[model samples]
Target: MINYDLYIDGKWMASTGSSRIEVEDPATRQVIGSVPRGTKEDVDKAVAAAKKAFPEWSRTSAKERGRILRKVGDLMEQRKTDFARVISLELGMPIRHVEKWHLKSSIREAVYFAHMAENFEYEYEAEGGWVRREPFGVIAGLTPWNYPMEQITMKLFPAIAAGNCVVLKPSQATPLCACMLANIFEDAGLPPGVFNIVTGAGGEVGNCLALHRDVDMLTFTGSTSAGKEVGALALSTVKKITLELGGKSPLIVLPDADFRAAAEEAVYSVFMNTGQTCCAYTRMLVPRKNKEEIESFLAEEAGRYKVGAPSDPDSDIGPLISKRAFERVKGYIEKGIEEGARMLVGEVPGEIKKGYYVKPVIFTDVTNDMTIAREEIFGPVLSVISYDTVEEAVEIANDTPYGLDSAVYGPAEEAYEVGCRIRAGGVHINGADAHITCPFGGYKESGLGREGGTFGFEEYLEVKSVFGK
Candidate 1:
């Protein structure tokens, strides 16, 4: 059992750690570990420590801060197995996929920010005077449970690299890995109170951080509804806020495209993280003539992802995060059928009696207006919507509350042209790779602000203009 207390002011406090929040392994639905259910008092302590540490930490030389940030990545590499095991145990992502899916990006994010800290210009001449970039004090980082490792690193490294102190409250379901990260920070020689962790219910820990007057900025990654609540809560303080929220992104296949290869690639893209990704291409828009062919290819490719436990090396797909997630995804599949979308591949029921498992679902003959096509179903479910023309394809793709991420698989000119017409924050042309350095965010109700590379690093900074020479 991995048991931990609130990490505040560089020490573990267990006086209020009696009330425990149990952590479960989704693969077995077993209580594998637990962490303290922190209260508002704990949040207060964490915020106070961060507030106290801000002045000195923010004033530290950029090079020195970069050195610390680099050390963090180095320590993570040294203890890579620990991070993989804890994150896999909590998130139910296959351990075999850890190094590739989670740890690589997490480590790279830390290192990327380390370089930014060392080389990024903190002050530069603009117009007639010099402009300065300064860190905001006491950043409150609230992360979701889906991609626990990378999400935490995404929020943490950038803010710290920009010289801001942080008080983080990770999803209650994934605190063990966050606690392990805290241990790594301590060994990396991060100064006392520069980084703090408070784990508990969002209403208590997360709400407290959002409401805390000391928190200068809030960065969150989760659902659109929850992002609204968090953004609204932080408005009272009028602090800086950035959110990376939900999406119902589309994959458009033009008439000239290689339908089979595109369909197969789309299968891997959508079901990569068991379809829990916020920016996954859930909707596949294909020409009506090629719809049936694409559907057959999608089903064939999806079958390649075999479901099993996280510990099973041969397993390509693991269980959903919890009982609630499993049931929610299961409901989406049934709802798709009820709403008149034909299920091409997938099952409906309690076949695997144990873990929170749902077979990958593929829906064809789906309309843009149908509930299955519009909503963000965070599971291994794909909806294929056939359009008559290229114009209609772009229209159907953009007809959604989300505009996070999309893809177009066709010839260079045609794909680029269609991708330009789609109103998404990002559009991948012909299966292009998503680099960690690129800016990532959304449009419309998806959320505000961008994350990754310089865009994300700058989110933690404040600009000041000086008039005199």
Candidate 2:
């Protein structure tokens, strides 16, 4: 079993408080590890460390910072197997999926940001003078459990690459990966206090970070309600906030699109990670005339994803992060039925008694006004709503409060036109893959700022114009 202490000032030390939070393996329902339950005192120490390190780290040469971050990325690559195993156990993701999606994706993001640090335009000419983008100093990164490492890295790497020091509060549910990252940075020889981690319940450490006087910026990734709380607190302190919140993202398939391909992509998009992703295409808009044909394709594709133990490399789907998540998803499934949406694919498996597994569920004949279609369920649940015309599909896609990510499949020209009309941060066209080079985040309530690539690097920076220069 893994045991962790608080990481402050680049040192692993015991928490000021005696409380500890036990980490559980959702698949086995067993205590796998524990981390210190950090208090306000811990947050103070961490923030103090970051505040101390910020001046020097922020002024450090971009090439030097790039070199160090690249080393961290290389070390992470060496420990990829360890990261994959630990995350699979902690988050109950299939080992292979963790390797591909979490470990590798995070490593790539780190490397991408590292390169951006050296190559990006830190200073550019303006109409009257020179405009410089400088670090915002001490940043507090509040990340969630679903994509623990990726979420942390998405915030941490870019912020650091832009020359900001950070205090990270990873989700209490999946803190192991964050602890491992602390070790990785130390091994890569990052300066003391440049990076720190405090693990505990959000009410304690997270809220403290949000309201801390020393914090200059706050970047959060989680539910919209939780984000609102964080944003409100951060706003009180006037700290710059970048939030990547929840999404009930939509995927549209035009009449001229490859029906079978779109259906398969829709299933893969929503069911990846058991549908816990914030930007998942949980709402699928298809043609009304091809309803049965689309349902058949979805069912066939989803059947291939076997729900089993996460340790099995071949397991296509794993348990939810915890019993709470399982129950939450089940409640949504029952709500779908109550709202008159027909279950077209799978049901909540009543036979699973051990693990917190929910069968990949697809609800057809779903109206845009239904709960299944309106709410962000954050489960392996898909709501397929039929639309008669392209304009109707666009309208249905934009009907939700969320505007995070969307997908379109059809003839290149038509899909591009449809994608332009959708109000989202990122839009994928014709089965395109997600690249680390692109900016990621949301529009509307889905989030507040952009992440990834140059946009992410800029998020941690504050612009100043030299008027007299």
- Give all candidates' CA lDDT scores: 0.89, 0.91
Tens digits of per-residue lDDT for model 2 on 1-469?
9999999998899999999999989899899999999999999999999999988998899999999899999999999999999999999999978878898888887788889999988888889899999999999999999998998998999899999999999999999999999999999889999999999999779999999989999999999999999899999999999999989899999998998999888998889898999999999999999888888998889888888899887898899998888888999999999989999888865744778999899999999999989999989999999999999999999998999999999999999999999999989999898887888989999999898877878999999999764
Clash counts for all predictions: 0, 0
Query: Which residue pairs in candidate 1 collide?
Result: none
The TM-score that candidate 1 achieves is 0.98
The candidate 2 region of ten consecutive residues with least summed lDDT is 345-354
Runs in model 1 lying further than 4 Å from the true structure: 15-17
Model 2 vs. true fold: TM: 0.98
Error (Å) of candidate 2 at residue 166 is 0.3
TM-score of each: 0.98, 0.98
Q: After superposition, how far is residue 39 of candidate 1 from its true place, in Å?
A: 0.9
